[model samples]
Target: MLRLKSLGIVSLICLVAACENSGANYQPVIDGPVGPNYDIDLAQCQSLAARQGAFDSTTGASAGTGALAAGGTTAVLNNKGTNVRDAAIVGAVAGIAAGAVQQQQNKAAIVRNCMRSRGYNVVG
Candidate 1:
């Protein structure tokens, strides 16, 4: 039994050592730019760009309309010699919100591109 135990211990040590050194001599195949086994479609990028453009245009127009309305209200308040600050504040808030939306849309486009580069099908 003692001899068998010694032999088992020796075998375990050899196995551990072999595993440790096995990976040292391994060389990975490196592909540049177009990686191995990765496929990306250019149409995905085009679609993303188009969607982003549409979102920007729509949001921008809405924000402009909102600002115009606020300006009109401010003008009426000024003519009546009442508080016009609130109208200006509301206009600023609406403009900021629209800007934030546009920023988010731009970020989404970047994320879509990244996902496509990572071999994912992005729809939007």
Candidate 2:
């Protein structure tokens, strides 16, 4: 069980680390003509967003929490031949998915907000 849990955590970490920050593709709707430094500013903001979105803290936290919760619940409900490891893995996967989605949203928002702060007039 310990080995299985450790393997799940390692896999989750690897997946999170390999995820690409979607902020690089953010194309905000500019209300008017862009400044001369628009491309540079956008690139900088995208880089910042990517760095910020590199690793979401909630991913590990939620994975651990979900694994424990699911394992405990499964053990309690299915006492006979209960596969707690499988349940834990499922829970961890779900947590990872949720965290990844939130991280992507955060990345996009970061890009958008950073552009707006730099006077880009992001209408979208």
Clashes of 1: 0
Task: Give me the candidate number with maximum TM-score.
Answer: 2
The lDDT values for all models are: 0.48, 0.79
Clash list (residue pairs), candidate 2: none
Off by over 4 Å in 2: 1-18
* TM-score of candidate 2 against the unseen true structure: 0.72
lDDT of 1: 0.48
What CA root-mean-square deviation does each model show from the true structure?
26.0, 3.6
Residue lDDT tens for model 1, 1-124: 4454456446544544444322222222223454443333333443444343323445556656666678678787574422343454456446645554554456455645655666655554
TM-score (C-alpha) between model 1 and the true structure: 0.39
- State the RMSD for candidate 1: 26.0
